[model samples]
Target chain A: MNTILRYIFLNLFVRLIVNIILGVNVRNRDRLPEVGPAIIIANHNSHLDAMVLITILKQKAMKIVRPVAAMDYFLKNPLLSWFSQKIIRIIPLRRDVKFVKEDMFSDCYDSLKKNEILIFFPEGSRGEPEKISVFKSGISRISEKFPNVPIIPVFMHGLGKALPKGEAILVPFFCDVFVGNSFQWTGDRGSFMDMLGTRMAALEQEGSYL
Target chain B: MPFNIIVCLMGLFVMLSIASTVVFVLKKIKPQKDYKELSHRVKSWWIMIIIFSLAMILSKKVSILFFGFLSFLALKEYLSMIPTRRADHRVLFWAYLSILIQYYWVYSGWYGMFLIFIPLYVFLLLPLRMVLIGQTQGFLNAAGTLHWGLMTTVYSISHVSFFLVMPKIGGLVAGNGGWVLYLVFLTQFNDVAQYITGKTFGKHKIIPKVSPNKTYEGFFGGVIVTCVLAYLIAPILTPLSPIHSIIAGLIISTAGFIGDVVISALKRDLGLKDSGAMLPGHGGILDRIDSLTYTAPLFFHFVRYLYY
Candidate 1:
């Protein structure tokens, strides 16, 4: 029953916010895996990023998509926690440096073990609008354990201008989503991070051509 | 809403259906050459036609609101394409708000306010808002591009909706709907005519830098075809005489070509192809209606001077 309601809520949110208010143009949509144990990584800029990523997935696939979000931001209060975890199904990660490093990715690992798709923003948090910040090595550490899981790099433009961090009002803008080919972990953490950054940069360049 | 207007729209539907059928048969016959783009264009045409017809067929309020929404979309596209300073973000909001007021004037039949809202009022107000932000760097470019975008996308396109509130002139067969039908039909017809003629008999490049595909053969051929059709259909759809209709056709064709090239110039300047991917094969709303931006305002004033 909760699953059905989540689908309905998400579909409504996507239709009203993503599709109607801000038109989205997606390229190479077929590159995304149909079902997963996969990671969909994208640039962080707006709060709308996670919802926009969910909007592009198939209905059945949406059931298994879990976005990795900061626990402090999403699970701040009871109401927000319920809305985030129950409604949106986000996997809240503890961002505090004092937290135990070994157990940090337990939830992400469990979700992947269950054959779910997890979305990651290696930039850690939203930065300046339309700018890509240096990626954190947290994603590399997590992917090292699941070497076979395909990591898809998606570069989104214009959403930051639509609703950037610290802004409540949404200015409608035409957004472009460019999905790059999926790649497995390259075993080395440093090389894997570089590959992900280059892949996203390439997708961003591809969007500029048209 | 008029019976004759409905008949004319039905005729348009028939023509579109025939075109779709022809494309389908050609795709099957020549399976090697890519018909994917052409087929997508035809499919989008059907969707556009349905939406346009429904908006016109609905009451005046819906039609006005619909066109206002279109202006909003065009403005959004324009803003996304151009690079603007961070200082102009609030100014951009006001620019969008101006669309509401402009369309309200159309709904209320206040022609004077509608005429000056964007060109005179919003034109002055935007720079003031930007000035308040106190960022002089790239100020001129931001102000100029933002205002110009509002002019082309919002102010120019709003004239189409004004046709709804236009007083019904005597001897008008299809009322305001026919007036709109006449203007839109001729404008789009001119575009298609030019493309087809240019593809078939085009040899001389009219302007290679701005638009590579435009040719002298296409321009003359489109003008001839549109003028002839305008002469034939003017009396049935509008109150224009044979001579006046021919003149309208000439104005629309030339103006349409100018609009197309102007946008092409913009795309070249921005180092991009097509504006956005709003429409599948057509590129964007701006891409599909680029010609209408020129034709709508010109045709509106032309008819207003002669009739209203």
Candidate 2:
């Protein structure tokens, strides 16, 4: 009951704020998954991107979508820690791991086993708005672990202007999210990364203005 | 009844009637391309204005709360459009939280604390929040942006309410609520005057690259006309000398132009046509209030120095 109320409040809160202030223009919402466990891959540009994705996805899906964020970054303080874990329901992962231990892999595997959608940014960090960076192997690893689950690629544009790197002032701008058709993941390591990168790049190419 | 309050109420009614008539005529002649959308938007505006005008007349507390929420919405829109990295989320949270607290202080009538709330408390809190996140990448930029949004949208806007809460300027006056209304009226009038004059008589663009619609002729003409109106209206709403009323008009008109340009540049950089489509022909809440952002702070400081 509490979760339901929270979701309702969060949905209304985000919609009212975004529509009134941010002027967020959401498109291709039909592409989002109606039901099931899947991987949501998106471009990382602004902090608001996570909120935008969560807000839009919540409108369609029943089960809560969990965003995989860096523990070192989002979980560093009490307020943010609580907000991420409790409100946003983000799963925290250590970014600077020296080696991928069996324990770490199992934790991620366990999240997938729960039949929950997990959002991942293939680029470990935000990159230039004009270009997509070389993706890390996180998506491939998740794909290999959960071959049965669908991998959904999403592309977000205009958040870079909403809050760009090295600029503190937030200039008002419009942003759109495009969710692409999902595909089943194969355990093949090399092909998996290439396919993921290719799909993300295609989304970027289609969405890019310049 | 106090002479100024009675006169101001009469003037407000007359001006509102004129504005309504003009809007109604424009609706008939132009016949909005999207009539349904325009009607929806105008209905919302009527609701908002009715609520706002009632708050102003009925309860000081409600008026303060309404304006505070307006500033909060404006700031939220500004922040949502900017791109902050994951590292800056903590700072963003603090920045938004400060909006609530800043307005609360204004409502509570803590004059001294309200003065330092943003620069002292918020300035210190944002950086500390960033530091706690332990990532210095884009630290300076994120903190600075958060502060800028708060300063303009929250701190600046709260001053309008502050003017209302202030104790009588001298034993002769009870409160400067009239002055608050006067300032808003004059500033918005300057905006309308500039638009009408520029559209009618403007030929030479002031800054073609920045805002092509703005003209030197329109600017000077608008300022002169608004100043005259300010002079005529001041006695009805405020206890200002004619010279002071003229000064107030000049200040609001000139400062309001700067605010418009600043937000215009923001839109240009972002490659956007409108801030949002919340208002038809008016753009978003940010678009409508962009001029207020600058004028509010300046007018507040001016009233504070002279009266308080």
Best by lDDT: 1
lDDT of 2 by residue, B1-308 (tens): 34565556556667666666766777788874445544554555565556656767777888788888778777766765555666664467567678779878888899989999998988887888788879987777777877887888888888888877777654323246777777777777788789879989999999888788999988988799889988987777776778888998899899888888888887787666666555565666688778888888888788678766
* DockQ, cand. 2: 0.07
Per residue, candidate 1 scores C-alpha lDDT tens digits across A11-48 of 89666889887899889999876798999999999999
Please list the residue runs of candidate 1 whose C-alpha ends up more than 4 Å from where it truly belongs after superposition. Answer: A1-5, A100-102
Best by TM-score: 1
DockQ of each: 0.64, 0.07
Clashing pairs in 2: A21-B77, A162-B81, A162-B82, A162-B83, A163-B82, A163-B83, A168-B145
Worst 10 residues of 1 chain B by lDDT: B84-93
The CA lDDT of each predicted structure is 0.90, 0.74
